[model samples]
Target: MTGKIVVITGAGGGLGRALSRRLASDGDTVVMLGRTLSKLEEVATGIGERAVPIACEITSPDSVRAAFAQIAETFGQIDALINNAGLFQPSTLLEASDELITDAVMTNLAGTAFCARAAIPLLKRGGHIINVTSESVAIPLPFLTIYQASKAGVENFTQMLNLELYDRGIRVSTVRAGTMVGEGMSAKIEPETMMRMFADAGKRGIDMMARGASSYESTVDAFRLILNSPADLYVPSVAFHGLPAGWTDAG
Candidate 1:
């Protein structure tokens, strides 16, 4: 679908930035949404005319509604809405701060729901809503209780949402995702927190620190493939996984 309007949250950096560039190259008009206008502008500048940058705090319903209204006026139609904005602050349930936990739920879970709801009226028939969720739901991890819990909710929401939106020709799907490598992976958590998690993992016979993240290109490619698939074919979801780049039994 050349020239399709694709709205992506968190398009300022990481995999979101990469996807914006990738989809734009394929003739899609990419609306880049992020909390910081400066960061969104930087990304839009790189993509030239094919991209539009708008400041939006996904955690706020009012911000999301206004952003989507602007998007509807600009494009008149939306082909896809990618919910990629996420907050990952790793900490055990006992050790995590209350604010961190609230932020995680609001940004990862509520934010996604807000975007999807706002985009519904603007969505063209046969539009797609894709949620980016963590692979930890399938492969359990420790010290990321809040992060995993929120993403798991997103995954569940995607499935149920599919049933509701099916009659409207709007498909809801998700990507069970793994960590991205280098610049594609943005860690909002502190180094000390990470160190503590690693230490705890080591004590439990797990070596999370040694595990490498997936490359940005591969992760983007997975998404691209899913989007490019024939509409006549039915695909519930895509598992865009990064194999344990350094997963070892040395522990």
Candidate 2:
């Protein structure tokens, strides 16, 4: 993957920042895209030259377009795109305020698609788009209806584009990741939402830590497997929690 150009959204912190470092270590030119330029710059500083910060608000199509255009002028071309920017506000549909609802829809659904659309023109043959989804859609945890809906939309988009983008020599896939807790990430839930969520999980005997928290390292490996797979092989969507060292057979 040396010299390859990879664009990652929400690269200011959390999973995005960790993933940005992975790409940098692998010798890929990582463009760190996020709403806050200062935060992106902070992360980029640690990564040095390989990671360049780019400000982008994925929810707005204009922001996405201009950002990609700037990337093109600066980098010449993009090899892959990782649409990892999202908002995960846990609340019942009834309890969700207008702002919360809008944030979820815009960031999770519209934002994901908007970035994809903005990148398509710049992407050439063999380009890839990897969308980061969650396991909550399959687990269906309580008080997360809105969050699940947005992720579900991304999953649907990934699946649909997998076939649609094939003719253009592009590949699309989704990582239905399980609960990931790490530096800059909080495992804590809101008081009201936590009570409701726990009550429902108890009834269903749902233990999220059942698989143990997925580490940033394992997730990076999972992504590497997908991104670097043989061009002859067919890579489908995958889900992962924690994978033992040298466990590359996970598909």
Candidate 3:
């Protein structure tokens, strides 16, 4: 595991960037894939020779195929595929535009599947596929219906894929992540819409806007642990959440 070649989608920012850095620091070669070449390059430059930046629009199959091909040619084989690229557009169902809905499904569900399929042939036996999902799929945050639904589909897909790939010596697993903040974290909602969503979440006693979130850097350890698991041990899924800073059970 020390010198493994790992490919991560959305590696330009947020958790992907953090994971890429952490993995490389741990002695693995990291392929950073994202829609923006500049962004990916920025990260790769920081990681030096261990990092490979590739421009990839995960929502497009052709783009994904080409990026993976580049990865295959450069590295010859990959030890892991981290489906970490996603788009989170918050909007009420009534206010949601066609593009928002389409992007969410395409990027979160379709893109993940496409990457997994493309990586299948290149994956060595004992290779792992890690799919990142959201805690909101079960927590029911306001104005995230489409996002939640799409990720729910991914969770189910991960389960079925685990079974399907068992015979091939591949392992599929879900990392049901909680709220996380990092340098790449961003929100593009209009102020009015954001206010409405906050109000609605407050009405339900969730008050998500004020909730504490884990840092993206803090979550990288999970991926490291999963990738280094013993050969006989198979982790089907890992679910984690953030608590208020300094929070304790005694409180």
Task: Say which candidate scores most in lDDT.
Answer: 3
In angstroms, give how far residue 222 of model 3 lies from its true place. Answer: 1.2
Please identify model 3 stretches exceeding 4 Å from their true place.
248-251
Per-residue alpha-carbon lDDT of model 2 for 134-153, expressed as tens digits? 98889868888998999999
- Compute the lDDT of residue 72 as modeled in candidate 3: 88
Candidate lDDT values, in order: 0.85, 0.84, 0.91
> 231, model 3: CA deviation in Å?
1.5
lDDT of 1: 0.85
Residue 170, candidate 1: Cα error in Å is 0.9
| TM-score leader | 3
The segments of candidate 1 whose C-alpha lies over 4 angstroms from its true place after superposition are: 203-205, 243-251
Q: List runs of model 2 lying over 4 Å from the truth.
A: 186-188, 208-211, 242-251
- Per residue, candidate 3 scores C-alpha lDDT tens digits across 66-91 of 99999989878899999999998888
